[model samples]
Target chain A: MSLLSRKIADAVSAHPQKGALTVDDDRYEICLELRSADPEIGVSFDGLDFRALDASPRSVETLKAWGERLASRLTYLMEPLVVLEVDRIGTEVELRSAKPSVRESQLRYYELRLESSGAAHLRRVLFDRDTRTRSTVPCTLGAEALERLVEDFTATAA
Target chain B: MRKIESDQNRFRQIVRGKIKSDLRKYITHGEMIGKTGGELVSIPLPQIQIPEFRYGQKNGGGVGQGPGDVGTPIGRSGEGDEPGAAGDAPGQHLLEVELTLDELAEILGEGLALPRIQPKGRANIIEEKDKYTGIRQTGPESLRHFKRTYKKALRRQIASNTYNRNDPIVIPIREDKLYRSWNPIPLPHSNAVVLYLMDVSGSMTDDQKEIVRIEAFWIDTWLRSQYDGVTTRYIIHDAVAREVDQHTFYHTRESGGTRISSAYQLANKIIDAEHPPIDWNIYVLHFSDGDNWGEDNRQCVSLLRDEILPKSNLFGYGQVESPYGSGEFFRELEEAFEDVPNLALSEIRNKDGIFDSIKEFLGRGR
Candidate 1:
């Protein structure tokens, strides 16, 4: 394999969750959510599709499946995945977990947020780890609203 | 196939002609902005019909040999007509042609007579890039220099006294292989900073906000295309100045008296702290309804003349006319910066005036 492909493969192996990527900018709005495994809450980028990125990752099968379902809904790709990583130390996901944690740069920003709680809430919704930028208002939407929007879009896509 | 391709090109030319003739109308009405995907933008190209050479029916008495009665409906069977019920003369057939965004931008640039921005900062930034430094005796032909290799082999053969005139077999030794060289130098790229200041006062209606939103998108598109890495900052003010997100800048509704100077102050502060004139080319664009506090005009004028204009590459004041606005500020700006080189002022009367205003603001190409 070429060096670039090898590196990308390595990255995929190291990371969890990946999906298809589609490129379309027709009428679409991406709705994101912040939640943990316990709550099971998720968000959506309404009208955007992602079937193309389905096989890019190695170990992130679960993430890939979610991406598959999400990709099935839309006919176009809107934006590339903006990611954030929650480190083991102070991540919302880490904090919520039962296991003990240690020092590490686990939390990285896909998008930054206003407060820690809000940032945690955003990370959970967007399912990304890190928060970036100067303190800015975190995007807010109710769990029900997120699900409703996603479900409505999923129905239309079907 | 080549003829068909040429015909296709002619059709596209017709589509572009239609667009150019009514470019201002399209910009104003926000038509032809429907985007499809990369390399394809859906445009409502009007009245430009697809090329069709309809053959006459075999039995019809058409121009060439046919068997039917004299002039028995020369064309295709029938596009059925019910002659009445508010008669239908051939309805305008608008073909939606998908032109690349670059084509659209080029057309817009030509129609508006906008001067291309001369790139500035690219020459100054000390970018250290590695290129093949210089020729060497042995490297790879992906980097090979044939002349250098021949010269090296000839010189080596000559220097070592292996020169023979009878049989000139100057075979290149392993050491004779040479490679071309490259050097890394710092390249400069011009930088531009765009400061968008808007009035979030009560007088500015949602319609006005929508106008600003749409105009800003096109302005950004054109300006970003003009300059690499264009720095954009949003400042909104009602009675005071504050920074806001992209979403809030357009959607945030506030109800306070107008104080145009507040936005100016914030913009000036941003300029002072982040973008100095030496390192950055600054552009300040202010969108306001001319309803400033009567006493603040002098302060605004002084600021524009002294601090803002000096530091800015272009200081554009767009006075959006609103129902409640006195619109006195536009007149004041006209009188104040009448001969100013980089300062441009445009009056946006309504949605229809957006194209003209954009042209007026960026036409000088400062």
Candidate 2:
């Protein structure tokens, strides 16, 4: 295992939400967002509120190794998600997901806006198929909020 | 415009994905070499499906809005129709997409998880360059700024109250012309030179040459992306070594015996005369069948230890497997200099081995 993978695994294992919370019939996915300066790790449940945590790097090699490891982790995490979206913020990896209720016809997408100070804000939106209209949804839902939203949306949409 | 840009970006992403997925196949094949241009390579991708509005058959189809007789020909048949076995599958269409060498290198690095090369020994050289800094009033017509000249003419006409709303034409006079001016600026640029030495002895078959050619193309692509200016020199050796053009480097066949020291000697001379160790990042890559004169092995090792390895950023030895040649050179190099930092060695047994050979040669990020 590379240093970056070790660090990411350590961070994920030490997080308060580690294996303790489940939302939308899936476990919370942990991600490490890398940057050229002052890199951080982020964790999200439903592609929102990617909480950034602090990290330290020994050199550029560690950063590059971290990126490769993070990509592998993201690929593994995406295997079970209904919708997977991967983007980059500078040198960082931004992963977003949606519940299975949001079908492909809904044209769902997510974006993360990273400020200069290294804070990230995630937004998710879906388009209506019949009306050709777009509507934004609050993506920063916690475990309880995500569970309720997924249950309600699944029940109502079905 | 935004929609078109978004579509273009999406298409580029799809192309990248296709290239990444078939990277190993591409590394082993030399089809893209013929399509390469100065800084861009055209890759033929057969798997990318072009999206189009495929029309379906209309219900109750008739020529004149009425039902036609069954088994009746409505249109004339072409003359080329002949009795042959039918193919139920749709024909495949290949799309040739142009990608800059930088983009290709990025994909190679990401796909192989290759580390970024940290250039050693005076990575940068300062060169004077001309930059178009600002506009001037008098210069050659080739340097004339059309938009600036038109704007100047318009401003002059408006200031003199000679603007015509009817014609709406502002002709620029000599005084209103603007020309681009340049200034000499000193720029630091990273320059690299690749020394490609290949064994073209009787034992090295055409298949081995083809493998060397394919691997060289990809290595050149990746290295060229890292440096500002990359110069490639080709040397083909049997018993005697001689410099050759890129075309002759891969196609030539020699009947003489093998002597690895000749190529190294010529490479050393070339570096000492032209590419000095203090000014350029040098990469020395040699492809052979791991066969050499029994006595020359010690000379080759001594030359590498004394002259080549110290001056080179990387010294890569790729032993292409051949049935006619005894593969002993790689074992000698490994036994002598296995722990060297800049020396990278790999055994390429066939086309499939080119992928791993590339990884071994460039994995260290030298």
Identify the candidate with maximal TM-score.
2
Model 1, which residues run further than 4 Å from truth? A1-158, B1-5, B31-40, B53-94, B123-190
lDDT of each: 0.60, 0.69
Mark the 10 consecutive residues where model 2 chain B has the least summed lDDT: B59-68
lDDT of 1 by residue, B1-366 (tens): 699899889888888888889887777765444354765678776567777987678856646676778758866675666465875789766778887766777777888888987655442355677777788765666889888888888899889989787877788878888888778775545478889999876557787877787677667667766765577899998667798888889887664446677788888998899888877878899998876653778889988888999998889888885543235788788887778988998878789879888998888888
List chain A TM-scores, every candidate, in order. 0.21, 0.30
The CA lDDT at A27 in model 2 is 22
Worst 10 residues of 2 chain A by lDDT: A80-89
DockQ of each two-chain model: 0.01, 0.01
lDDT of 2 by residue, B1-366 (tens): 698799889989999999999999988888898788987899999878876656577744655644667676766677557787899888876788999989999999999998888776556556889999999999999999999999989999999999998989999999989999999998757578999999997667789999999899889888987777789999999878999999999899875557889999999999999999888889999999876754889999999999999999999999986642235788789899968999999988789999999998888887
Of the candidates shown, which would achieve the greatest lDDT relative to the real structure? 2
Clashes of each: 45, 0
